[model samples]
Target: MAIYFYGCVTMDGYLADSQHRIDWLHQVGSVEDTGYDDFYKKMNVTIMGKRTFEEIQNLPDVEKFYQATENYVFTHEKELKVKNYQAVEENVLDFISKIDKDKNVFVIGGNSLIAPLLDADLFDHLIIQIAPVILGKGIPLFTQSEFQRFYHLDQVRQFGQFAELVFSRKAPLDLPIS
Candidate 1:
């Protein structure tokens, strides 16, 4: 499966403010103005943390927002309010490994969720849209990890006030046999 991460971060590389609010993202531009719609169309499934799910549950017609994809929310809660989303309590890596290989999985948010996957080098593509604003202190997109993973810049595009950077995991080098 191709695991993808698509989200907006501040120039300083923060996903949200200190309060874990994405209000800054709305102030800069709307989702319609960005390439989100096009990117969302290709995904077959979505995975997100409880906080990320809660953040979006307040939206209008939230039930239908991700109707197209099989949504999985990693939470300790016994049940989820949304019938469409399945509540998962297992390890993110283990849970993701069970998904069909042909599916396109989109990771919504939560640095906690992304960090482990990134560290394990399971993320296939990262599409980060860099917003112009910079919040000095906030929840950063990347946290300290032991190992480093490399990616190649696939493409760059401007979406109004946001600059989208598309990166794909670098392929392993084929060494010559002596």
Candidate 2:
């Protein structure tokens, strides 16, 4: 099973503005029109940051996900509660690794959730939507520094002016040890 992340970013690479505003995103393209629907459908489990969970609560269909047995929000705020979301403060990877191997997991982010996973090299794939506009300052898609990594372009698709970039992590090739 593949554990991946999917979100729309600006041309300059931002998921939201300084104030955590994604209004600019809706100005250019909508979630339904974009490839998000298809990407979300394939995901059986969800792992997201607390800020992201807070942001998503405003969505009309947030209640729909309460049915999932595996919906987690990584946060230190033990008091933070969002209906059915399980608050996880332990090691993110340890929590993630325990999920059913048969299910495909989606790491939904406001950038905070995926940073450590990216650092630990736990993610297998990353699918990003590049919106047409740019936010000079905002939350970045990847928040890690000094962590070297590589990926192979798996696919690319266009939705209106937005571009969907799919990348699969390039596992290091095994070599002779002798």
Q: What lDDT is reached at residue 94 by model 1?
A: 94
The lDDT of each candidate is 0.92, 0.80
Count the clashes in each prediction: 0, 0
What does candidate 2 score on TM?
Answer: 0.86
TM-score of each: 0.95, 0.86
Candidate 1: misplaced stretches above 4 Å? 174-178
Count backbone overlaps in model 2: 0
RMSD of each: 2.6, 3.2
* Predicted structure with the largest TM-score when compared to the true one: 1
- What lDDT tens digits, residue by residue, belong to model 1 across residues 113-173? 9998988889999999999999999999987497857788999999999999999988766
lDDT of 1 at 61: 86
- Give the 10-residue window scoring lowest on summed lDDT in candidate 2: 169-178
Candidate 2 wrongly placed segments (more than 4 Å) = 65-69, 79-81, 174-178
